[model samples]
Target chain A: MGLQRGVCVIGAGMTRFHHKIHKDKSGRELFVEAALEAMESVDKGIERKDIQALFVGYFTPSLYEHQGHIGPLVTDWMGLTPITGWRTETACASSIAAFMTGVLAIASGWYDVVMVGGVEKMTALPTEGVTDALSVAADDDYEIPAGATFPGLYALLAQAYFKKYNMTWEDLQAIPIKNHHNGALNPKAQFQEEIMDIAKRIGQREGVTFKDPLDFLKSKYNRVIAWPLRLFDCCPISDGAAVAILAAEDVAKKFTDTPIRVAGIGFGTDTLALHDRISLTSFASAVFASRQAYKMAGIEPKDVDVVEVHDCFSIAEVIATEDLGLFERGEGLKAAVEGRTALDGDRPVNPSGGLKCKGHPVGATGAAMIHELWKQLRGEAGKRQIPDAEIGLAHNVGGTGASCGVVILRR
Target chain B: MVSGSAAQFLTKTFYDKLKEGKLIGCRCKKCNFVMIPPRLLCKECGSKDLELVEFKGTGTLETFTVIHVPPMRLKNVAPYVTGIVKLDEGPMIMGRIVGVDPNKPEELRMGQRMQMEVIEEDGKPVLAFKPVS
Candidate 1:
């Protein structure tokens, strides 16, 4: 069944995703910063009392900050108490769940206006600590004991994909190259420099020159984290937050004339461990979730004007494009190489630079994807904007495809 | 050997059998579905009535990766090979792929036959696989 009542996002906001910039800020402070920006983004303006309730998604507060019970704490911090608030989590897809929860609340007609957002204070912990914390999202008793890291898990998928498609690691380089190019245009992106520029800088410091981005990528400086997956292939550990203010259709215009409607939202799950999945090249969760979303939206993949998919690893973007039906299976890598998924390409994926260049603050990533789509749909995405973009989609995955959520939005 | 009553498809029980040089899995009586690192219920049909079965400990290498940046727990064993094995009985599981140079992952090929090996890590049995000529 479709939503009982129409729901739309009137405003969205996000802090620049980075590791060091937000170091002095706590998760609560970062969340409030984003929420204030969201409220300010409303053309008609809004107040704290206008929000009826709140939903927050934070993946690992306990391990990262020795904290829990974030929902009420953030509500209390925002001074919007007693309005009913809680936390929702599905690992990296946490904030999308929060966004969906807010949509459901508005659709239920229980609350006309509510706040949905996510926050992650990942920089508090060291890299190894972050790795150990994120591993909890996998099956601790099984996958973790088998020595599976997140990148290693995706690398296995890359291996299977390469063997199945007659592709090589060289074929996947187009993804980071394109994303970094897009990231160079997005001021909020953590790495706002093109790969070649970065290569030139590093080359000068090391007294070496590179012919192209590929040469720099293949160099020892790009050192392997997992076979076929290098440092540039992964998203960095980051700290930030993103927020979206949602209003029911009737009252949405009171907030903004160009409200982005929540046309379709879908979520799905598969076996937690990678070995249990029927296919390694594609995520069953992405297929199921995107299918549900497309059915609800009554639109095909071609109708989507732009997209923001979870590219936690470079290989993931290629797989996500196919799973979401943007490209045929085994054709995703080729599409990336041909620039079909570039900013100016027919199918633009991750114009906001995705998690790779955008910096993935896990819990905040899903809502942050929404933040990018909100800008694109409203014609506010500057420089990296997709012209005449009316319909946009966001795909977020959690824990090696154990959980996934897809949201489709339109102007 | 552990008592039959104590074999309830628990992780401890699965590893205990691995400690004894045996790889035991479970098959659901209702759906005839088998799983390694066995579960209390069948994933296919959700049946609680299950029977323990031993695997031949052999399968094909479906896919593999060499982890260069190891997690803190496995730091001393950096650059270890891990892969999924499609067991003969139809269930697939993850384990270390040994008997090959981790530094030379190019030597590995998909669909190669492999045999299971139980190796000890921190005094506890851990599952692994090795290529068979």
Candidate 2:
């Protein structure tokens, strides 16, 4: 069935994702910055009062920022209080969940124009504390209690992938290197400089010489956090915000003539514990969500012109590509090493640098992914633009692939 | 001195059995799905008919990861391999890989035959898997 009413993304915005102390600013402040930027992106801007609803996504705000009731807090800061505002939490895919809700609300004829935003201020906690907080999204009874952190969990996936595909640690480095290369061109990316640059600087500082990027990657400083997965392979603990303005297709043109239509949307959830999954190489949530989204869009994986898949860790991108049906099972790593996912490659994946380099702000990651696709589909992506891009897709996944949201956008 | 939280209860049971060289799983009555960590409910049918069944201590390596930087409790045993093994009784279990080098990939192939054995860690019988000889 078609969306009862059409929903189109008219504007998008994001705050540079970074690690911020609570003393600097709160998560609400970061959301406001992104929301304001989104408002400015609209060609024919409407008054903030005209916004009918707001969807906000945040993870561990109560623990990280010591803030609760974030829904009203963000609306109050945006001066949209008294308007309907709700908080959506699904770990890293929280914002995408909120975005999907906003889309459904418009399609259901409940709200004509809605402002969807996601924010996370998690860097306020120390590294150990943050890891503990994020672990709550996983199956606490099985995973966390077994001394499984996020990295450890993903490292398991990495190990499985390596075993199944006969890959090496050096192959994994290709992901971070590519993402960093793209991130260097992105002004909003957290790790803007390539890791090789960092490696060179460290070598110079220590009066030593690195054989190559892989050599530096293997060193103790960049030592493995999980076996076969190094510190560089994991996404950083980040703080940031992102927002998008969605409107019914009838009213979307009023805001902008070049609105990106929400062609399809799908979401799915799977077993919280990794042990319950039948296969570690593919996320069932992503596979199911992609199937639903593709069916609704009346397209296949081959139709997507550009893509933004969750690369929370390097191995995740490999898994996501296979789960999304972009490549054959157990072949995503080979694609990455072969330069098939590069911006200039035939299929450009994560031109936004992905979470690997773009920075994952948990709550904001999903919406931020959509924001990148919107820009790419509209030919607005400055340096990392995909050539001849028309149809774009974004896949946002939550803790350990428990939840996933996939959306297709077409210009 | 054992914490009696619900999360720890099953692991405690497993630990108690580990001391006796037994690996246990919960077999579901509704779907016959066996949970390796011994869950309270069946994942496939959502049934709570769980019977603790001891595995045959033999399985195949489904996948694995070599951890270079272990957590605080595992730091002393850094550079160890952890993997999911598909047991003969039809369930996947995650545990450390013993009796193998962590750095070599040629030794850890998918679907490689393996067998489980109990090892002492901190004076507790912890279960680990080794490549079949």
Candidate 3:
């Protein structure tokens, strides 16, 4: 919601997302991998010295990785020392928060070329420990003390959406099904196989006959971590990193003739506690952020050809589509059920799978979404490309919709 | 019967009564905001001039979730329903839902009337809600 200076992504990169405990690869190692890949993605090789500043996004590395001062550490590891660097954190939206800061800084004419990266090194802790670390993003005194986990919090939203819209569990299943279908096409996706494969494996292991995928999804194993949400609905705890190079629009042509311009950017925040929110079905932050982005881009929901929304939970994508104004209130699940958000539908969403399938590495997820959008808009997303995608949008949310960032790109 | 932790510190006399199927909230003298979970201080006015008030365990279901997977402590109780109930006394409380089918999303409607039932969990009386027909 400021001056409309143009910014373009010159390169993008990411490390393979996985559980890396014994390898001793820290968050900095992951960031280096992604930064190298991004440098390689550029047509003309970029020197480490060319990066004027570095922006890093991370969450709970102090707890999980036992490392802090991630900004300078990543910069030093990437051999971009002497360049100014800082870390931005907003729980899961850390990477996007960094990306947004880089954009704003460039727009303000503070810097010409900048590198943005997000990294999260979870999986070093046990499942319960991870849950406890993530719960810190909530209202610690009120929500966490009452035994509210992220899954339980989102489950409340899912239940409210279902109750208000007359939707069934089947409607929610459509999200995982669609995301997994797309994830299978992505080489870097965490869960690259279809859900039916999981079902078959479980059936064989348990010596029980699973009638179909639907039955498998509804099985006790997939049952809710918090009621109305099952294991399948949640994004996996992952360790990954992503990087993108942003340059002022005037010099963008020097990198790539076909550059995707940062058409719009918006961000908003809400109360940390769910109890203070007026509606459970929609996030006020996302609505406000998307509006800001749309207004800045001089576009509307109708102008968006493709979207990559935060599907940290399967239900999140449903609420995001509605909150982004892609569909009217209480109609997001219906749109999803009707396949309107499918790859070949009117408005393709999450073509690179999503956080649900592509894996959510907290800080990395926001930058990863932008990386996917960059590839799609440049017509480089093989097998998962939306046809003639002139405009694309990315929505990233942090901690049960407490913080949200929306970015729009135009080719 | 209260848990060892609750028994270790009998800070509020009403907490002892809550274990006997009594619903109690704290009313602040300044703002008159009733806290269902019974806060030590008023959230609105930050007043410690609080008094305990018994609440009728009746309300409406504002929202709810059918938890298919539970935490390790509640693993045996998978497929349980939990919800935020807006009590008649003007306080929202999060608790488990009893006497309902978790799989039946159709049955869990918002604004549906609910009545509270106190169940023993870890030797402590835990309050829950049940849909009223």
Candidate 4:
């Protein structure tokens, strides 16, 4: 069902997503830091007490921070206590769910202004611990017990998609290369170096020369994490936070004259386990959510000018693009390899560098995507800005596409 | 969601039969819809009338992956091949592909006939698959 009144995003902010950067900062600290930045970004400033309620999305505070009940903790940290707050968890898409909740809160005439965001502090644990933490999002009894790690699970999809479409792994190289390029321009991205630059730097440091990007990717340093997904193809563990401020459309002018309207919002979920899905080649959750958002917004995929997708892996970007109806089935791979998704391309995808470069802080990823869309829609993206960008879409997915959220924004 | 045997499906009996090298799944008597590892109710039609029927122990390899980095439980066998198979009885199930080089995943062809067998690992029976010659 559609909302009674529209919700518009007036301000958005995020901390630099990195692995070791936010070492001493706790999840709540990161949340407050991002929240303060978002508050300051509004065209016309608003006070903290003006925010009616808080909705925080944190995937696993127990695993990372050894803390639970993070909703109250975040509100307390922001000094907005007793204003009503709740936490959302959907593996990686946690923050998007929070954003959707905040939008509905405004649309229902329940609250005129709401603050929503997510935070993930994953560097507290070892790499193996993070992998295990992410894997539990799948069906515990079925997938996890059978030695199914996230990469291995996605590897199965990559294999099946490759076999069905007669594709090779070489086609995937384009995605990382492109993301790295856009990330190079993003000041806040975790990895801001181009793939070729990284290759050259690593070659010099290791005293091993490389001919090109592909050659460097094949080396032992970039060794395989899974069968087809190399280390370069996977997103790194990062700690960061992102927040967005939403206000009712009629009352939005008080906060910001340039409010980007949340034109459409949609959410969908499917069976957690991988085997239960009818088709592994595409994410049904993404398709269902995107279709609902497109229908509600009265716009097709082609109407979207710039987009950001949940590219947890290179293959995931392909699947998300096709599932969102941005590209045809089996055509996403070719689109990636042909640079059809480049920053300056026809349908620019992930101009914010996506999860591969902008960094995936689990809970904060969704709000970070919205932050990028807010920038690009306002003609604020300095180097990666799409010319004449009017509308943008953000697609965030939880573990293995089990949960999905698609939001369409218009400037 | 698959809480326990109290649901009448997704119970220990599914794995118990596998120890004897028997493949069984839930088959809907009314709709003739079959599912691997059994289920309390049919997902297609919500048919509660179901029976455990022995499968032919054969299927086609739908997809597979070689896990270089396994979970904490399977750390010993770090690099192993696990796959999804579309059974002859019309259900997709997860099984580790045995009798093949895990590193050379390309050798595992899709749509190739695979024989299902129950293999004991750490004193627990798990469903596995091998290329049928």
Among the numbered candidates, top DockQ falls to: 1
- Candidate 2 docking DockQ: 0.37
User: For residues A56-82, could you state the per-residue lDDT of candidate 1 as single tens digits?
Assistant: 999999998899999999899999998
Best by lDDT: 1
Q: Candidates sorted by DockQ, descending order?
A: 1, 4, 2, 3
- Which residue pairs of candidate 1 clash? none
Model 2 misplacement above 4 A: A20-23, B1-22, B38-41, B45-50, B57-61, B66-81, B96-133
Docking class of 3: acceptable
Query: Which is superior by lDDT, 1 or 2?
Result: 1
Sorted on TM-score, best first, the list reads: 1, 4, 2, 3
Choose 2 or 3, whichever is better by lDDT.
2
Residue B12 miss distance in model 3 (angstroms): 14
Reference-based lDDT, residue A275, model 4: 81
lDDT of 3 by residue, A1-411 (tens): 545577988999988676653147788888998999999998877787778999999988998988889989988998878888989999999999999988987888888889998998888887767887787788654464345678988988887788788897778898998898899889878888888888888888999877877898988868557766788989998999999999999878787787778889899999787765778889999999999999999999999998999999989999999999999998888888889898988878899899998898898999999899888988888899999899999999999999999999888
Q: What is residue A368's positional error in candidate 1, in angstroms? A: 0.4
Off by over 4 Å in 3: A1-4, A20-23, A204-211, B1-58, B66-82, B89-133
Q: Give the TM-score of candidate 4.
A: 0.96
Candidate 4, residues B28-124, lDDT tens digits: the string is 7788887777878887799887777788988898888888877667878878888888888787878788889987877878888999877787898
- lDDT string, candidate 2, B36-130, tens digits: 76667676798866677778889898877776645555657767777778899887777677889877845777688999987776686766889
